[model samples]
Target: MEHVTDTPTVKAPAERFTGDVFLHPIATPAEPARLAAALVRFTPGARTHWHSHALGQVLHITDGVGLVGTRDGNVVRVRAGETVKCPAGEEHWHGATDATLMAHLAMVVGDGSGDGTSWLEPVTDEQYAAALAGPGR
Candidate 1:
C-alpha cells in the first residue's frame, strides 16, 4: 500500500448545493477501481441538490446530525456513527439539519464512468421545509 498525502478542502459547487458546504476528497482511485469517497461537511441548513448514482452510495455520519431525503417525501435523520445506503438511481438529497452542522463520509460506487452521478435540480426550499417538519426515521 502507498501512503496518501492530505488533500485540500474545497467549497462545494453552488450549482449543486445550497448554503455553505465543503468537501475534503478522501479517495479517488484509478479507472478500474470505480470508487470515490469524500468527507463532506454541511453548515446548518445546507444541502445537496437532487441526484442519483449510477451504482449506489453509502454514507456514514461523522459528526452532528443530518437529514437524508428522497423524492418520495421521505426524510430520515442520521446521527454520528449511523450509516445510510442509497440504492442505484434513487433520487435523493442530504445535508445538515436546521440548527446543527453535519459531516459524513460519502462512499460512491460508480458504473465505470468517471462521473457517475446524475445531478438534478436544486431541492426547493419548500421541499426542505416540509422535510424538516416531518418526522424523522
Candidate 2:
C-alpha cells in the first residue's frame, strides 16, 4: 500500500460555504474507485450551502458541536463521535454551531461524473435562526 502524502488542506470556497471552513481530502474516486472522503473543519457559524449528493453522503463528527438540517426544516444537533447520513438526492446542509468549532470526516460515493454534489442556495438567516430557536436549544 502506498502512503498518501500529497493530499493538501483546502479552504472551502466562499461561494459554497459561509464563515471559515477547511478540508483535507483523504480519498478521491480514481478510475476503479467509487468512494471519496475528507476531513472537514468548520469554525463557529461556518456551514455549507444546501446540497445533495448523487450517491448519498455520511458525516462522522470528530470534535465540537454541529448542526445538520434538511429542506424540511429538521435540524439535528450532532456532537463528537456522532454521525449523520444523508440519503442520495436528499437536500441537506451541515455546519458548526454558532458558538462551536467543529470537525468531521465526510464520505461520499461518486457517480462516475467526477462530481457527487449539486449545491443550492446558502442557508438563509431566517432558516438558521429558526433552527437555533427550535426546542432543545
Candidate 3:
C-alpha cells in the first residue's frame, strides 16, 4: 500500500488549455502499469485543446456541467455522475460551460510509450457557442 502525497496539483498548461484549468494527479503507477488517473477542474468556459489518446480515455463527471465535442460537430452535455468514453485516436475537446464550473475524473490507458495524448488547437469560441446552442445532451 503506497500513500501518495507527493504529486502536486498543477495548472494545466496554457498551450493545451483555454481559460483556467487545474489538474490534480491521482495515480501514475510505475513501469508496466499503463493506467493513469487525474481529477481535472475547469473554471467557467475553460476547456482543453483538441486532443487524442494513443489508447483511449474515460471521463466521469464529478461536479457541475460541461460539454464534450468531437470533430464531427457532435457535442455532448455532461453533468455530475455522467461518463464519457473517447476511443483511441478520436479527436475531441471538453470543457466547462460558460456559466458553470466543472470537474471530472479522467482515466487514461496509455500505449506504453509514456506520452499518451496528442494536443491540438484550442477550441474556438464560435464552436463553443454552437455547442451550447446546438441540440445535444
Candidate 4:
C-alpha cells in the first residue's frame, strides 16, 4: 500500500462562479484528478447555463433545495441528501430555487484532456421564469 502524505486543505473562494450570479466552487479541475468535485452554493434565482458532459456528471445535494432542468423541459427538484445524474451529452442546467440558497456537490467525470464537457450559453431568464411557473400549467 502506498502512503499518501501532506495533502493540503483548500478553501472555496468567496466568488468562484461565472455569469451575473454568485456560486462558489469548492474544488476545481486543477485538484490533481480525473474526477472533479465542487461545492456549489447558489444564490436565490441563480443558476448555471445550459451545458453537457462528455462522460456524464453527478450532483449530490447537501443543503437547501435545487432545481435541475433539461433542454427537453424536464425539471427536477433535488433536496438535501438527494442525488441527480446527468447522462453523457445530455444538455442540462442546475441552480437554487427562487427562494432558497442551494448547495450541492457537483461531480464531473473525465478531465479536460479527452472528451471533456461543453458549456453552452446561460439559461435565459424566460426559461427560468417558465420553470418557476410549475408543471403543465
Give stretches of model 3 more than 4 Å off: none
Q: What is candidate 1's lDDT per residue for 1-137, written digit by digit as tens?
A: 86889789999999999999999998884677877999999999999999999888999999999899999888999999999999999999999999999999999976675648899999999998988888862
Which pairs clash in the backbone of model 3? none
lDDT of 4 by residue, 21-80 (tens): 433444456434567666677778878878899889999999988789999999988889
Residue pairs in candidate 4 whose N, alpha carbon or C atoms collide under 3 angstroms: none
| Tens digit of per-residue lDDT, candidate 3, span 14-82 | 999999999999977457778889999999999999999998899999999999999999999999999
For each candidate, C-alpha RMSD in Å? 1.3, 1.0, 1.3, 4.7
- Error at 37, model 1, angstroms: 0.2
Off by over 4 Å in 1: none
The 10-residue segment with the lowest total lDDT in model 4: 11-20
Q: Candidates' TM-scores? A: 0.95, 0.96, 0.95, 0.76
* lDDT at residue 94 of model 3 (Cα atoms): 95
Whole-model Cα lDDT of every candidate shown, in order? 0.92, 0.91, 0.92, 0.75
Model 3 residue 131 CA deviation (Å) reads 0.8
What's the lDDT for candidate 1? 0.92
